[model samples]
Target chain A: MRFLLLVIGILYITPVLALSPPTGRVLLTLTGSITETNAGHTAKLDRKMLNALPRYSITTKNPWVHQAHKYSGFSAVDLLKLTGGKGDLLRITALNKYVIEIPITDFTKRGAIFAMRKDSHPMSVRELGPILVMYPFDDDPKLKNETYYWRSIWQISTIEVLTSPSKE
Target chain B: MVKWFRKWLPTSKLQHWYVYGLLSLIVTITLLASSILLYSYNGNQATKQRIYEDSLWNALQFQLQSYRFLNYLVQIDKKDLPLNGAAYTQYDLLMSRVDLLRSGEVGYLIRGLTGGRTVRLLNIITGELELISLNLSKIEEGDLSYLQDMTTRLKQLDNQVNEFTILVSKGTNLYIARQRRALGENLENVRILMMCFLASLFVLCCCIAKGFSVFKINQRNNKQLLIDIQNIHEEKAKILTLVAQEARPQIQALLGVPCDNTESSNSIKESANELLHTINMFTDLALIDIKKLSLDITTESLQKNLDDYVQIFSSKLQRKGVTLVSYIDPALPDVIGLDFKRLKEIILELLLNAIKHTPEGSISINVRPSSLTPTQQPLNLENRRIGILQIAIKDTGFGLEHAIQDTLRASPTTQDNQPLILQNNIGLGLSLCYRLVHLMRGEIHFSSEATSGTEFWVDIPYEVSQSSPENISLYSCPDPKRALIFTTDNHLANALRLQLSSFNIEANRYLEGPYYDDEDLDLVIIMDSNLISPEIESNIKQWQKNGTFVLYDHQLTKDVQNKAYAAKAQSLSFPLTQSRLNGLIMDAFKTD
Candidate 1:
């Protein structure tokens, strides 16, 4: 019976263990690009580096359902700055190879945060956690369209510095 | 498809709920989809960077292993070299194999892949591998320096790769964190959106409910308004029926009793006449009085009609012994375009009121020339003019009270205390008269006093056509001592007598007869058709040689004045003015 309890505990704790902050020396690069406010800056990020940054979470209702759920992430601005990317457009890629570009300004204007947790717990792959991009879509109805929805990439594993020309 | 949906879901049923649901769904979907995309993208990017780092590390490891093999070969002993063919062959084969492996691209990695102590270690390893594999005995000084240079190049390549890998790794971590955070936020937003949508739908439903309530209230109001209109229509119909019933009996009772036995009928007729007179007087007062006004009247038929009107009005008020005194001016203009019937109604109404109030007093109708600017003059062939007249009606009966006088003067409306229906006949009559006066663009003034009684004076403007020149160019000069006698054939003698006190002319009266009189007279007027007779024509011819004798006819013919002038005599017609008479006298005196 003791052994059986030990096995159950391990099964439950394993996922929690996996969720601990990644610890190591993180390497990163920086690039100069335009931001949403038409300001130029550099940004870059890595796994080890992101784990070292500040974290936060919030609960809110989403477009698809009436139930509210907790979301966790870092400030989108801090994450972009680590990547050394100053472009208005940030192209994020997930481990599953899904790619999407988000406006960097959407982060600064709306207090947008880049998160890695949900309900105070590290997000799992199925939960679209590990990495997710978000904006304060609750404050405005304009974010309810598919354009903004499609721009939020999840399970993010990498970010590339795509040299974008300034449109403004 | 939409029509089918409305059949069951009928927007009216769940409009509010549906709106909220739609809003919530839209918000949540957008946020969730965006978060998923960002998370997946960050994950892929991180994986790619990791793979590339691994590839670099593996490449470096492979380079190091090859260097170790080279070092082992270099450490081989030349002193214990193979003395026989078999041993030499073995050694040579080993050396060749080493050369084959170390040469080309793989050899270059081993040669250049260096960083920190790793570069020196590879150099040592490669030298040892070459010596052992190739059986070399000693190393040249020049070769030693070259080997050291290889070590330096390897060190540089290792350093570069390490720096690049570290930078890329840091970038990957940050990007992943960002994607993760964004995903969380999007999810939160989606949740919030769902709530908002639901709330909006609730509001929409409330609005629809309110709209329905409003529609019901409006319908109720419309129904009430329709009922009110029906009630008003019914009330008007009932009033009309009552009026007809009352009027029929009163009229029959008034006339039926008169047509009975002879003696009673006569007595009844007298009373009836009195009643009729009172009724007639009321009718007259109710009508407008434009016809009673005058202009230079050449139409005698209109005078006869007015006389008939006066007689009718007088007979109705005999009970009060109310005498009607009329003084119609002969020079008044003929009333044209006037409603004679309405005029009679107004007069009759006034007469009735006078008779009713006055026990024994005269109601005088006086007409005289108005002092106001006369717009019409009587037709006068002699004076080239016409006359204008004004009329005033006064009652020597119960005088108008101060209050009535004030009202009449202030508003041009006269009210008498006479009752007719639910209202007063006098009030209606006065209001009608006031309105008529305005319609004719005339003025009506009221003058009254307790002692002298009340008077209503109407002023009407008129125009007349005369049988004279529109513009006169008479050569006749003025003379105070002489006059021109003009006559019409109808009772010329009597007509002359009516003018006895009117002109400053000597009587030159002569019927149709021989002229055996004064040959030195200043003027002579002939009205006899005998003026057209040969004997009279000759006499007038002889008379014109010594004096002036004017010939006129009953119907003053056009251009007759010119004919008289051609005959050297001044001819005048009836209705001649004093001024024209003076002018004719002056002309006659000029030749006297």
Candidate 2:
């Protein structure tokens, strides 16, 4: 009976907890298996909306970039928790429609950040970001390899979360 | 084989080599194991996955987006659609991928594969897309010129992008093959190392096994050798007992009772005794072969035995006119524990050898306690030294030749390695005596000159019994007479002093010459009578005065005897025994 009430409570409170619609140009979208929404099932976020949620900064060397840079944005784990994400997998797509599925645990375990700004300025498309999922490659030597480098998807546009068996 | 190696492999000296060999083997094994581990570690480090897989994605993504944007443009021209956000977004996607080819990990990969052709192509595509994106709003319906131009370029770009994708796939496959081969080499090295480790371990175990086997064999051999030595001792004892009981009496019985012929009778007895002596000697030699002979320790009165033996030999010495001088120490304890039979054999052999060599000269046999350097005890020892007995036999007829002196110089060893002279250039009888002295843990050596004499000295250790002969008061029957000793030999002089002291005689010795004037002395005694000269004769005449008895070698010519008689001196054998000294003192005092 308590579980049912908690479910009802969450459902009723979910509409109130839902994100406000993006006010400026929509830059990123969160869809599928998430509770936080603005447009029925999708949460469209602009730089203001993402920056408004929470923020962190990382100064790190990346394989794609020529030099070390500072990126500020919401952490993937924190962003997922804010959206009430319930999933085993996060399917992220870049602006070029290049898609890759990363385990949600990868983001939480590695502390990858979805960066909206570089060097305190909003990143342009030419910078490989409107928002970039920048892994702290310099923080961990293991991230220099192909397995983790593929997970550092740039120019990230959308993330559709869904549940799946861990073995696969 | 092990015996050979035992001699070759010296102990203690080669011990460090053994340790060094083992240490070197361990070092080799350690180095080998380290090498195997290091190789595998480096191989793993070398094959660690790198980020070049992103290049394959970049190339394939670029190809797909090129055609999609071109098809989107064709649709916009055909459907008469307005210029919109989708065209710009698609253009922006194309531009970003081209930028990645120009600057990202993809750029690094493409330049290595085709010398930057794909990157240059992507730049051209980037410019084309940018131009189309700017003119998007100016496009009017039925004006498909920009669309036609872009589609043709997209077709050309798509084919080249597809080629770049194939090139990347081949390169990735080749790199994976090389890494797999390196991993295979590391595994092979580990396998070889394991095999070598097992082989060396097996070799070490075999060597240890061999060492243990050799040690056990040596232990068993040592045990067998000790048992054999014990058996030899038992067998020799049995043989000695058998000879004493069975063979000897029969040999003694071989001679009939003596007819009334003194010389012939003496010869028979001498022959039988000689045969018996030979048998005893061979038996002792057998004992010497095994170990230190077990002595039949008996408490013996050495004085009585020496007296009897001297009596038996005196008649024969008389026949040869070789005056016998024998002195037995008065200080000898009345009874002492000794191997008397062996000592008798030694004395008999030495005396017989002396008699055989001397035709007509003085032979002196002196028995006294020898004061060779004492054992590691205080010099005094509270006067408790029941001393080592020394018997000296000197014959004045014929001295030893040079060859025999060499043989004597190579003295006999007392151990199981017996004197080789038993079969060497020495008389077999003396050789027996040497073995007998050694069996008693004593030493026998000789000094001889070519013409004067040879002296055989035997030192035999014995324990004195509690009963000693009577002290000075017991010999009160003798009137004390002054006797002057004249001899150059220190040993004979000392023996003569001991013998004279036993008789309660006042005796003084001059070792170099008679350089004093003591006219009251009753007798003048001299040794080696070969040492007597006119100077000694003048001293002797003055000392004896009324009647003087002097000693000189019988081998001297009549002229020497006449000179002694002209000086009113009587000649006697030298180093006088106690009884002879007693008789001489009685005569000297009677004349005085």
Candidate 2's clash total is 1
Distance from true location, Cα of B470 in model 2, Å: 45
Off by over 4 Å in 1: A1-168, B1-300, B313-318, B373-389, B412-428, B461-592
Clashing pairs in 2: B529-B552
Q: Residue A148 deviation, candidate 1, in Å?
A: 76
Q: Ten consecutive residues with minimal summed lDDT in candidate 2 chain A? A: A12-21
User: Candidate 2: where are CA atoms >4 Å away?
Assistant: A1-17, A86-89, A163-168, B1-52, B77-85, B104-106, B114-145, B173-592
lDDT of 2 by residue, B1-592 (tens): 9999787564742343454457547955895777767686865555333534566666667777777778777777456555545566677677777777666555666667656665565566566666656565545434556767766766766666676667766666666677678668867777777677767666656556655666677779879998997797679767876886687877678565655667878778767777777887777776666654577877677766776677767657767866666777666565676778888889888888888887766677887778774463221224444458789998875777677678767764645545576666578787777777877777788878757778999988776565654422224224676667665555455556656666666677765544555556655665455555767666666655665455443344364656644455555543245565567555645534
Give the DockQ-based CAPRI class for model 1. incorrect
Model 1, position B11: C-alpha lDDT score: 55
Q: Against the correct fold, how does model 2 do in TM-score? A: 0.44
